[model samples]
Target: MEAKDDPAIIGDSEFTALLNAARQQDPEAMLQLIELFKADILRLSKVIYMPEEDVVSEIVLEFLEFVQQGKE
Candidate 1:
């Protein structure tokens, strides 16, 4: 995992705030959330034999859609 992804690097409350902010369409928060999960994303992508960039894009798109749905 990347240094930023390490749970110990951030407090639980802070992480929760980050997640909430991302759901609100805060770009920086979304990017931070992506950084936090990037290692797992890459690992999953490798298992499916797809390109890493494509997997990343797909996941981000799906996440954004999920957030949008929550607002409806």
Candidate 2:
């Protein structure tokens, strides 16, 4: 699908703002970022054969770690 046609696709500025807020540990912005990846995460969950909730948790944990690493 075209990027513009994808609801998960945010404009560059909005994404940067969101990422910044998320990195600062803003729960609302973090949730928004999670929502953006929900579809892809769910799809990954199907192939991984784990509980859906666990899959989501694992990915979110990894994403948060990556974001935290950027602060260093």
**lDDT minimum window of 10 residues, candidate 2:** 63-72
Predictions in order: lDDT: 0.74, 0.85
Per-candidate RMSD, Å: 3.8, 2.0
- lDDT for each residue of candidate 2 in 1-72, tens digit (9 for 90 to 100): 457588888899998898899889899998899899888888888888889889889988898788757752
For all predicted structures, in order, the TM-scores are 0.69, 0.82
Error of 2 at 51 (Å): 1.8
Candidate 1: tens digits of C-alpha lDDT, residues 2-59: 4666563677899778878887879998888778777777777776667878877887
Model 2 misplaced stretches (Cα beyond 4 Å)? 2-4
